[model samples]
Target: MTKLFIATTALATVLTGAAAAETIGVSIPAATHGWAGALNYHAERTIARLEEAHPDLDFVLATTPDSATQVSDLEDMMATRGIDALVVLPFESEPLTGPIKRIADSGTWVTVVDRGLAQEGIQNLYVAGDNASFGSTAGEYFAENLDEGAKVVVMRGIPSTVDNERVAGFEGAIEGSGIEVVAMDHGNWNRDTAFTLMQDWLSRFPEIDAVWAADDDMAVGALAAIEQAGRIDEMFVVGGAGMKEMVARIAEGDETVPVNVTYPPAMISTAIEMTVLGLTSGAPMTGDFIISSELITQENAEDFYFEDSPY
Candidate 1:
């Protein structure tokens, strides 16, 4: 009778453990750009850590180049994988909304990172960096450092809500500051295009005081053009998205690229962790998770430095 009771208890424990293990699907945009590449890196690392910590839980990672493909990917993941939860960094907002909403309606937990969905009341959680604050901080820095009336050039990223918010914030901060924006152009968040645009701007506006590229990759190209032109006096460049190389510049007090604002790619990790907590610990995480942006300068560069990071 005692042996039978022990055996029954062991079987019950096994069944409980099996029921606790949940499968999570993580879908993100492909690593076509530096920021997305960094997102992939952080997502992979978070998965590894979470899996080791909770041996029963399983994680699936998927990436696509565009929104339509990502929508398809999400559907396939749901149909074939039997995912209990989802963590997504959408490529774009509109095309992804319907498919993601469908997944949410199927009772799978959803955590949306960075780009938000067009349709509301779907995602269980939302995570993102403060993009508007990123631009506003940079603009404030430029205004304080330069004379009251400075001519500046702006290089924009892809035409998304994120880009528009940053531009609006920067312009709002500098309003009535006596700073004139000499030229503004879309760089498509590409280094080559930014370099070409900066070179053209230099030729067009000889009295430009500074360059703000909104992101580090474009800032690198702009920096290269400024170097090649041999125009270093009273010229400054600012960028965001805490790329390692740009953070290093801040640490070294590089005058030309003196400062940066952070929109770290690691926000994906935050989303994943939150989703896990929501599923396993009954944590109430069903709300927007907006991360803060900070200015990176020589005094505070070490805090943002990650030696092993790819971006």
Candidate 2:
């Protein structure tokens, strides 16, 4: 017999008059960057708190380095743990759709966070940061601050649905603003990758005015490149995700790093918490839970700053 079958049979014999424990499986990408590191941090803490609070809820957490590993992790969770629910942040949209759909099809409640699946209606609860607003907020700042025909570059994150949404929002916001995007490329949301991409853009474009490093980690890389090129004063940068350091710089009225957009990595906590609540409390948790994004400027940066935050 399968382990799940054996365990269920044994539990039924031992707990004839008691409630059985339910399991939740959480699978996400490994901490490949600063934002992802923060995500893992929040997920771990949330899981610990929930496990302690709800003794009948068992959690199986897995961090995968890539989509293939994530797929394998899900298979193991199902085969061995017999999880009742699943919470996932896909490494990439396309590769994970089939695997996650299969899980959902097996009657396992699915809560998708951050990066969405390629297929729709597969997840019971969807929790994520406002990716479109995250982009548009930064775009609005660039539109208001830069002159007409000002040249700028962009650094995008890993190719996923959220990245697409953020870029679309940014493009739509700057449609008629006349702030030209001279170059755009993927930074994979890695500081080193962004640093290299920014270096290349600096060498090719001599008159760049601003940068929209879609992520704060990329912004740091781009800033380093700009400084190395001695072009720090010529251009400013806008990045999303209120990394504490980035918010601090904005609060101090730094000219090169003036503003930021909020895309908290802690949204993973929301997904895990809501999923557990839905399973245990029978509350209405179906549907999207989108947290809105806000711009962080010198006037109100203090409101967003978390001095003890890891991100």
Candidate 3:
């Protein structure tokens, strides 16, 4: 956990000239779920747009399905590609830290997106959504909607710093509010897994009043499960991320999915854009840029919906 801050003045030397040919390596997770699919879509779009604008700049985008593949892909980029900079959205924190840090040590400027490496000082710039706000926002919604002493279940995503931050934010917001969290489990941010988890919840908890699905995919799964069990009338579910389907539900006034929180996958665009700017803008992009999470309700669900989006 070393703190190696990049000074603004020092980055000017690393900056590539606008007219010169430059290469950037981008590593991201493969589209494993709804949010990640949107993330990949935005990354590819950004890469295409940037290439169109800066003909001299080449972006080498690689998507990995797991940490091992991500690590190997990054290594390949370092060895074969003459990349001046790297934009990485780590597949997993701990496993990818060493390879990512190696890129930095090789004198390539690094911009990390979404999930951060376990070790600090590995990347010069960091960008991600507000996991704390993501959690607490949904928790507040549950607190307001549910009756006092109501039984609630929580479905968590994969284990990571983001997951911990979100769960902490949620529990912090609902503490002592009489909204008892009767059960909590991992959904792994996958629809099928979340559906199975929700199915189990239905079988076990006969009188559950509400559920906080920490992600949009999980919320969709939970809704499907509740419908199958014919308990849609009993519990209201809260999910994060402004997924098109979930937003549609909110817009349609589907009581089963009462509300949602915003955690858009488009933040990858910001990280990629910033990385490109850092390379050619002759300025420092050497700090944290955290995207905030906001609540999505039926009153403004249309604002969050994108009809063409796959997620």
Candidate 4:
């Protein structure tokens, strides 16, 4: 419950002092897309503010393009930096689990963010967006907005527990609601993959009443394909993760993008800040911190919009 404020000019001397006593390493995925880009932006800004607030704390941030690189980054952080704590968003669940467990076993406090590890109890703290709410919120929109038995297609993200929870929540929400999912496939959270998959679904199904692209990147691809096929007017698309462009469209009353469910990239800031507080203030931070998702409509889109944000 400790709050960190930006330090005033009086602490300028600490700015040039020796390295801080505690080192917290942050390893996250590279800015491969809009969502990840915003995530990186938030992480960096949070670390910067925390650094200024507490000169006794140090931070090491690494962005990895893949699981292999992320594993290597963790290894190097453990061996060379001798980080006292770690905040990691695993590239994938399975491959990074053992390596992260090894780090935890070595007495390092681990905080897992967003994508979870395959094995539980490995992290001292867990911070992430509510994947189930991310899905169910979108599903509820579909159930209320679409007609009974309306057909739709779904695009999933990468294979992980996060993706699984979202899909499961969606399924549970629409159960017996008379909404039918005509087709579903993995878009891997990539725009191109979703475009290709959407194109194929268009070819097979004569009618698609709506689309749940799940992530904003996949939503862009689905929209492109839908527009290309000249079926833009036939169905609307609902995506999660609150990409700035998509929220803007929703604000502008774009029919194709009527609404968005939020899974904020800023959750990284929560994890980093909490980890620092636990280390510096001796506060208890050994538990899950789940940030809830909300539905973004034109009525409140401006509240979620950030003009300065990269995503």
Candidate 5:
């Protein structure tokens, strides 16, 4: 009787262990830019946290620089590893939709983060930041801080739905505010490109009140150009994407960078958590999960500041 009881206990332990083990696959664009780098950092950190908390869960993180590469990575992950769940932040909407849809159809749980798929109906949960709100919030800040008739220059990102939404929201906010957008051009979301664009705008325009580099990476370059040209007092620059360096400036009450708009890269963690919740607890989750974009000002800078973060 004693031997039989011991055998039953061992079997139960093995069954519980098997039931607890779970696998998750994450695919994101490679860290070619500041925002992508931050996303990579947050993804790794979140995976570490989740793995520690759930010992039986295994997470696989894959990053690709382009749409084609990402598709290939996804295929390799699915074929070799047999992922139970997948969390993807695609490089482009159209190229990724069909491939991701096929993964979902294979009975694996799917979580789409950042960019959304064009075809839809595949994602179990979708998590993304409010790109429009990111721009609108910055516009509102500019409207309040600058004079009514202040002239500003705008530096944009790579042409995409995300960029379009931000530009639309920003323009909409400043429409009747008497703030004139003197120049608007694409910076390709790069520091050097933004620096060059700002230099040209400076040369063309005699008096500029402010500048907005929609992304922090470009903002850093814009600041460098302004400083190099000895035009620090000529304009105040505002950059979105709550990068660690910019957040620090806000914390220090830097007048030129008094406020920043947040488009957090940590949002991938939300997608991961939602995916896990659905798989483990049978939780119902679907549709878009839009994270809020809050303006990071001196008053609330501490809230958004992450000291150890690479971004």
Candidate 6:
């Protein structure tokens, strides 16, 4: 009779109480670029450690290729996973706002990472590297490092609020500078796309002094294009985000990559850590956590380089 009772209780626990487990859902973009790749690595590592540390905690980690699929992932998590909390890094802000807001309305704790939603106040907590600071810092580096009459080309990322802020901060800092922005185009934060754009620029323009590829992945692409065009000696590249490889190049004082801007992908780990704290501890996570972006030069780039880092 005792054995029967024990079996019955175990069955009930499996069938009905799993939803009662403390579940956290993580949604982020697929690793389409170097930054995104690092984000994925840190997120998975964090989730593994958290799950081991707290056996009762459950994690549902999802990656989306685009905004539309991300919406479906959110809905699926809500419908089937019984998530007590959600941590999202939006693929695109506007398309994600409504679905995320609906999740919040369902009483799920929401912590947004990196890119924000189109609508504000939808998330209970927001954690991201300061986009404005990233841009201005990169811009200021140009203003200080390059010549007054330098010819620089701009490579932009996808259309989003973060991108806009980065561009605005960069432009604001370079105001009245003798630096001429010869060409501007959206690289969509993709390496191949930036390669194509740079190739076109090389073919069209006889002289290109410098290029700001915005993101590290784009910078790599731009560099390849420059090498292929045999313009490596003519120009230098400035890329944001402290990718390990990029940081290493800067640490070695590579002339082509003299400096990089810090926009670490490990910010995803930060958001996950804070969200886990909010979930486990009595203190809830609220308001904004903006990470500062800084310059990575030869003298300081060694500090940013991690030998075994995935990115």
Top candidate when judged by lDDT against the true structure: 4
Can you rank all candidates by TM-score, best first?
Answer: 1, 5, 3, 4, 6, 2
How do the predictions measure up, each by TM-score? 0.93, 0.87, 0.88, 0.88, 0.91, 0.87
Clashing pairs in 6: none
Query: In candidate 3, what are the lDDT values of residues 179-223, reduced to their tens digit?
Result: 999999999888899999999989998899998989888888888
- Please give the TM-score that candidate 2 achieves against the real structure: 0.87
Model 1 regions more than 4 Å off: 1-18
Candidate 6 structure, TM-score to reference: 0.87
Model 1 lDDT tens row, 1-311: 22442353356448776465577889999888788888989998998899789766777788898888888888877886678999998888888888899999989999999888998889989999988898899989987887877899999998889999999989988888899998999998889999999989888887889999999989999988888888876599998898999999889989988999999899999999999998889969899999988899999999999888888
Error in Å for residue 237 of model 2: 0.9
Give the alpha carbon lDDT tens digit for every residue of 243-271 in model 6: 78888888888999998888888888899
- What clash count goes with each model? 0, 0, 0, 0, 1, 0
State the C-alpha lDDT per candidate.
0.87, 0.88, 0.85, 0.89, 0.86, 0.87
User: What does the lDDT read for residue 256 in candidate 2?
Assistant: 97
- Model 1 per-residue lDDT at 89: 89
Candidate achieving the largest TM-score:
1
RMSD of 3: 6.7
Q: lDDT value for candidate 1?
A: 0.87
Q: Can you write out model 4's per-residue Cα lDDT over 64-151, one digit (the tens) per residue?
A: 9999999999998898778899999999889999999999999999999988888999999999899899999999888889889899
Off by over 4 Å in 4: 1-20
- Which pairs clash inside model 3? none
Model 5 Cα lDDT, one tens digit per residue, 1-311: 22442353356448786564666889999888778888888888898898778766677788898999999989987886667899999899999999999999999888999898998688888899998899899998888878888999999999888999999989988888899999899998889999899888888988888998998989999999888889887788899989889988999988778789999999987888888888777868777899989989899999888887778
Q: Candidate 4: deviation at residue 143, Å?
A: 0.9
